[model samples]
Target chain A: MNPPLLDVRGLTLRYETDAGLVTATSRVSFQVNRSDRYVLLGPSGCGKSTLLKAVGGYLAPAEGQILLKGAPIRKPGPDRMMVFQEFDQLLPWCTVTQNVTFALTASGRLKAAEAEERARHYIAKVGLARFADRFPHTLSGGMKQRVAIARGMAMEPDILLMDEPYAALDALTRRSMQDELLQLWEEIRFTVLFVTHSIPEAIKLGTRILLLTPHPGRVKAEHRSDGTDPAGPDGELLSERIHRELFSDAREEEAGHV
Target chain B: MSDSGTVRLPLPAARTGAAPAQRRRVWRNSPLLRKACILLVLACVWQIYAVQLDKPLLFPTLTDTLQALWSSLASGALFTRIGFTLRTLLMGYAAGILLAGVVTALAVGSRLGNDLLETFTAMFNPLPAIALLPLSLLWFGLGNGSLIFVLVHSVLWPTALSTHAGFRAVSPTLRMVGRNYGLTGLRLVLRILVPAAFPSILTGLKNGWAFAWRTLIAAELVFGVSSGAGGLGWFIYENKNQLEIPSVFAGLLTVILIGLFVENLIFRTIERRTVRRWGMQA
Candidate 1:
């Protein structure tokens, strides 16, 4: 069998805070195959975002290593484009189209005209074609994030690293955005390493979900989905089983639960 | 029982989301009108004081000062001197701003650059520009050179200090975003730090302009003719010596007017276009 698209082994991450060395993750391991909708789901402060950031090449592993294809991950490159949670991630000075084109032109991957053409294509895909010339500040929060995701997708990276891209939106917008993302994924078949705390989102989006334990995050379990239905009768049953494993806190309960 | 006697009241049209109220104010809404009233009051105070003194040599009357101002306007010599003073100030201000840019660029580029900026500003920011006049005269001789030298010193430190502070204030996420796209060195500084910290940088430019203006006037007053001619400062000095007290007052008034015009017109317009539009400042 071909090696997984991304191989992470015995990875550890820590922060040197003013008070002490805070361990965020300890010897966690996982693998992602090509075109896989891999979801890293856990509660807040569970080091899930930190783990994704490590894969994005922003943070280094303290112990084991993350391998992409066959090479070790060292620095951030255009190969792993990121979509951050903040609305201000879009450059305020650049128009929506310019924001995406800049990433292409600045990385020396495409000429100005070509970059602009691709930028418009993605902007259209995200339903922001009319606002192509508007500055980021003029756009709403959801619109700004759309521009950010467009810029990331325009790079056509090996894998898109999304850190809770829809977490900040209102419920109605978030639901619609999630649907849009899934539809876009179906069309492109691009690999995405998605991180979120919502259980239903994992069941709906992930081809496979990796559940992590609280605090210093550790891999608890992994589950596969049918990949054909979200509202199918079987989906409800799987979501409930996954929910139980997460909130049960088996090890914590043994210590009389903090 | 209550349903038999109860009455319902209609809400105000605005409360019920009818036509919005007219966007207008009842107070003195026009800034121009308010400024005119203030000038009129100040003129009255000046007239009263001059009447009490009853002397042109010691304290010229409002009318006598106006007469001096009119004669100068007619001669055109006052305009020439004002122009010269302004030209000198502009040269120094531009140089000072350029140097500050370099200093700030260095500060953000590396640790060593930051240290140099901090060390130099600490050493010289408090040293008055007028104090350097003697040294500048000895070095540059009696021309625009000496005047400009002192003016540059006055403008440089504050500008560099403020710009460095602004660079430090740019958001970390923005910095990471720039870096992730492979931006480093000058491109990163220009595309990211400059716009992010423009509010503080503008504050620096304003401070530098004020400092340069004062330094230019003081240097010219103490040193006499520069580049073979006297500017407004020399005009004030010569008029005072000749006992043309009203003309001296007129020269001082010219200085005040120019300062006011620049602060209100040029700088305020720039502020409106940039930081205010960006919503960085109100």
Candidate 2:
């Protein structure tokens, strides 16, 4: 196959807390090709979010490396925009349009007029054209997340790093947002490194899903789906197989220990 | 997570009406109206007491004080003194705020800067501005410069301390977002920290203004010694020497009125526009 757009090899990440030297992830290896809806799937405390952060260049790897477009990932840059799970991710002081345009102008990527126009386009795309002038606090939780998504998309970065972006939303909103995101991907085919603990979300969103073990996350298995309708028979089988692989490890470990 | 059933309960009567419907409403909805009523009652009490005492010097009647206030205002003497005081206060307040801005900026930017700000504010914040008047007079020598110096001292520390606290209070998520947007150093401060921390900064400005106002008046009491003209403080002092105590009361009244005007009008308008509009303040 052609070379991947993003590559990770034997990556380990650790952080120093009050408890000292906690290993979050260990020797996690993965590669994401262009236009791949790559999902990092795991249980809670799996360090999938930490892995995504490392890929976003926000965290340094204790060992190994992350390469984006054949580059050694270093510091946070405009090329990798992040969508945090918090509703307060958008600056409250800025209107919706300003929040998106801020990223463009602040990155020195686009001028004022161009950034505003582009932001408007994405705002409209997110069905938030009317709220373009409203503050983040004025918007509902779902609407705020949409604004954040629009802001991330307006930058048109090489990749979007979304860390459980819908995990905070209510059930109905989360379902609709998943569909909205898929539609956006269908249109633009932008590369995304999505971290989530939801199996259905992974099945529904990912072209290739990386299943990770519980703590100090290590890759358990990789599964690929055609990114078609998850309600279809093919998609259902793929999801079942993924569920089996994802859970079988724990069962095997218990059996071995017993 | 399920929405499976409908449940209803009678709402509390207290929640609906607060009290019996037959009871008349005594309190006005507007705080301003309520405060005005309070002011009128206090004035009446003052009038009655002053009349019984039948002495203007010891405690001037409200009307007597108002007459003195009216006369000075009509003669333009009070206005000029106000002008001088405001000019001096503005200069000192602006200079102090600008310096605090720099100090806060430095404090947030690096380790050493933070250490320096912490040390300096801790040492100087408790030192009253009046305590520095003698030093200011000795150094700047009997003019607006001396008054301005003490005013600056009064305004700087609290402003710096509050602003620094504000900066520290900016959420890590916001800071990370700023950094992700390729913002660093001064740009990070201006765009993210300042706006997010503005409520605290505005509080700081308010505190600093009160300090500067008090310091300016007290400094003028002594500053009038050589400058030959002081602000409202000089007016009060001059009136005391002449035993025109009602005029002294008028001067004190003018000071209070001006303070009320600024606190209610200028600062309140600013707070309403920026922090309140942004939902940073209740």
Candidate 3:
């Protein structure tokens, strides 16, 4: 059998603060196959985003290793493009087209003219072809996120690591953005390792969801959902089951505290 | 509970989402017109005060100063002075900027460079450039060299300080995004740090320009006596010795006009094109 596209073996992550070393995650392990809509779902402070960042090579692993196609992941590279949560992710100086083109050209993956052409293609895919020449500041929060998504897509990286990319949007915009992401996934079949705290979001987006416990996140469980259906063949809600699984840890911790 | 009858009325027809008629912008609201009016009032006050004082030696009337300015322009002496002063100022300013660039690059490159920048700026930034004139003259020997030295001194510290601060203030998210694209070292600095820090850098450049201009004028006032040929400062100084008070006022007016032109026209245009365009500045 072919090795998983991404392998996390006994991964541990920590960062320094004013106080001291803070462990974000410990002994977490997961594998993402090609085209897997892998979602890391957990409560806040669970280090889900940190896990995604570690995969992106922004955060160093304190133990074990992260391997991409059997090769160790090191510093950030063009191979794993990241879509961040903040709207400021897009360079304020560049227009939508230029922002996307910059990702391609700056990575040296494509020349200027070719990058521009591919940039426009992805911009069109994101329904931002009309605003291709407009700057990021002029676009709404949703539109700016769209430009960021286009920039990541334009790179055509080995995998796209997204860290709560739609969490900052309003309810309506968030729903629409989720739909748009699924649509994009349909058209391109791109591999995405998505991080979110919302249970429904996890069920809605991920083909396989990796549940993590709160604080110093550790793998709780991994569940496979029938790709676009939130309902199982047995007529149970996936969100309810996942919610129980996540909160069971919280209840046990509360009992211990009491 | 009893049922109550309610009346419904049709709303009156009104203009709904129609475009407003296009009209010319009001002259009363024009910034240029407002500023010009303020200047005119100030000029009138100066004219009235000078005429009442009737002491041309101390304070020349507005009309007399204008006459001196006109005569100087006609003889081309004033033009020569202005040209000499600008040439010297440009030389010093360019050298200052070059040195500031090097210092800033060094500061951004490493921790030691940052410490050096901080320590050097703290030592020099507060020292008035005019205070360095005597030492500059002794070193460079009574020429444009001395004037240029003081001007560079005035420009360098402020430019380097602001630029270093700007680079330090670039958002970490932006830095990460740049690095994520495989941009490293010089490429990362150019693509991310420089542009992101531009608003601060521009502020630095403006501060440096003002400092250099002030230092050049003050330096020339003293250095002009030692050097045979000099610029507007010399013109003003020579007139003061000969009791040409009106000519001295004319030289002063030329200085103000040049300052205004650079601030309003040159710097404003650069600000509009870059920082304002990028929405980094209001």
Residue B224, candidate 3: alpha-carbon lDDT = 77
Query: Fraction of reference contacts reproduced per prediction?
Result: 0.36, 0.62, 0.64
Q: Name the regions of candidate 3 deviating beyond 4 angstroms.
A: A227-236, B1-28, B225-227
Error of 2 at A147 (Å): 0.2
- Report the C-alpha lDDT of model 3 over B116-196, residue by residue, as the tens digit: 989999999889988998998789887888888888888899999999899988888789899899899989999988988
Could you give candidate 1's per-residue lDDT for residues B165-261 as a string of tens digits? 9989888778777767777777888887788888899999999998888888888788668557888899999899999999999999988989989
Top DockQ prediction, candidate number: 3
Ranking by lDDT: 3, 2, 1
DockQ of 2: 0.56
| Candidate 1: CAPRI quality band | acceptable
DockQ numbers for every candidate?
Answer: 0.39, 0.56, 0.59
Against the correct fold, how does model 1 do in TM-score? 0.84
Model 3: which docking level applies?
A: medium
Interface RMS deviation of candidate 1: 1.8
Task: List runs of model 2 lying over 4 Å from the truth.
Answer: A226-258, B1-27, B138-141
| iRMSD of prediction 2 | 1.0
Candidate 3 local Cα displacement, residue B140, angstroms: 2.9
lDDT tens digits, residues B179-278, model 2? 8898887788788888989999999999999999988888877656445556988889989999898899999999999998999899999998888777
TM-score of chain A of each: 0.93, 0.93, 0.96
Distance from true location, Cα of A190 in model 1, Å: 2.6
Q: How well does each candidate superpose onto the true structure, as a TM-score?
A: 0.84, 0.88, 0.91
